[model samples]
Target: MYYNCGVGGYISGIAKDKKTKLTTAMATIGGAGLDWHDVKSYLRPNGLLSYSTLNDGSNKLIFNNYPGGKVFDAVVLQDNSQGPIHPELKKFFEKYAAIHSKDIRATGAEPVFLMTWAYADRPEMTKQLADATIKVANDNKAMVIPVGLAFANALKDRPDLKMTVADNRHPTAAGSYLEGAVIYAALTHSSPEGANFLGGCEKPLAQKDAQFLQSIAWKTVKDFYGWK
Candidate 1:
């Protein structure tokens, strides 16, 4: 599996076999301060990766937004946030998740919940995020992709690597790799143990570290699914 993200890494293509190329379709519109409802607006098709907002002016918009009725194999939802587990935000999350989950299921597609990592500074949020995600996902009957667990497991061993960037919330390149790997393994049910695809962070992640994260992702996903 390869994790390639024009906007976000659906994944950087890491193939156990070097000769093959994996193609994926992903559209993202997010950053800090964006919620699941904000992202759900971009769920339309035609690869309109970005709608070309201000601040990032140099990026030329390539794909036009397609009309509605587009179908996806699975709809994975995530929000890059810090206080989402707060009492107020938790209610909002539940509301939006219900809306999006029902919409995805209505389209005959699987609804996947992306469990993102909380800041190491606010370690308490880790469990809160996981628990909240599981609760909401279960209520909606959506599969939970435990990327947060992969990050937690990876950091326990590879303390030298920075999962969050300088902001203490955003993910660094290695963090993104871990997220992608965990998502890939969860969705595919295959081990990333030997996959060499480093997504877009070859420099940030050395060969050994990349492989280490891959193993963690595989284990986390397998464990979450109760695989023997």
Candidate 2:
């Protein structure tokens, strides 16, 4: 079920790179929901299948069974919480962890938790978020992809990169690329320094900035997994 899981962050980046020459549907379709309830629904019966938008800007979000049930290798779960560490973050993670163990595991699929970043300006929240993520992973015995710490580490030496958007909450193009690199290292346990990528971005990223992001991602992964 590659659709629902596995390889954490790098799947899209690597998948896209592998098919760079392909035309049309070479992109990975990202499926997500408004909140935990919405996100969890996708794993159940009558979940999201597909949708479309018209030239008139009309669109619909459909929910139904996708083809080839229970065929995915693993299911990757992530908390979509925004802003500086929320007060109820722990509860939120615990609930997701429970869902992964009960529902995902029932399908013989391994659950993965994608540790995400905090708002760039709220630097202090990064460690807290990472800690909470680790706790959830340990509790559920799931793998934790520490992309947040990678972002924080890169910011220490490269704040000018402006990884997040103007609101400092969402990731910019370069930011998402760096995240994919971090996920690649976590999954492959191999250095991403040699990999050149500008993931899912329209405008070209500077070579120097891209290289630095890759290096930082590699460093963070190695440290997090004690890969020394």
Candidate 3:
């Protein structure tokens, strides 16, 4: 199950680049503006199979009322863009993350957190979100996909790249591509440097840009986990 806000959908196309077989049963409304608390409500014990279709800006799949008795290898969880760092919402983020982790474990699946980036104009939000997410992930013994760190790293290297749209919160196609790369690395522990998925951008990403993002994503993941 991919429980998300907006960015989680991008993983489908990116996963395809790495030749990762990913089948997502997404629980979200319109694919945006949802917090961890809202996700917990949708995943209540009695409504485990209740999910909506997911349009990852590439493919759209409808899995509502997904067939019962199915098991997933991992479930990715992403909170609202600011839930992890906002003063008022931080507590709820921690609380629901723990709750969701326990519930996901009970189903015998690993719970992976998708660490999100900050608003485009707020560069500092990257570290704040990462710190909060890492703390909770450690507490729950869950894995964290460090997309936020990758975003910061990429911007630090190439400040010219536009990672967000006009709203400064939602991801642009390039940002989404970077996210997909990070998720691929985190899940497989392999570099996405040579994969061919250019993402679902209206105009496919230039090979050089894609390669750069892939490199940044892999490096950030390795650094975050201290992997050689």
Candidate number of the best lDDT? 3
RMSD of 1: 5.6
8-120: candidate 1 lDDT, tens digit per residue: 34253653333324334554445522243444454555323324333377665554453454545677777556434776667777777888887676656677888878787
Give Cα distance to truth, residue 10, candidate 3, Å.
4.3
> Clashes per prediction?
10, 4, 0
TM-score: which is higher, 1 or 3?
Answer: 3
Residue pairs with backbone atoms closer than 3 Å in model 1 (clashes) = 2-12, 2-13, 2-14, 3-11, 3-12, 3-13, 4-11, 4-12, 12-199, 14-197
The per-model lDDT (C-alpha) reads 0.68, 0.62, 0.75
TM-score list, all predictions: 0.78, 0.72, 0.80
Higher-lDDT candidate of 1 and 2: 1
Which residue pairs collide in model 3, if any? none
Name the lDDT value of residue 214 in candidate 3.
88
- Model 3 C-alpha lDDT per residue in residues 56-104, reported as the tens digit of each score: 7755655454334335668788877888777887787788788888777
Please write out the lDDT profile of model 2 over residues 1-228, one tens digit for every residue.
022122223345543454432111111234322133443445544443333234365564444344655423455566553411466555555765776566767655577777888776777778887887778778888888888898888888987788777877667767777776776667656666755555433444677877788889888988888888
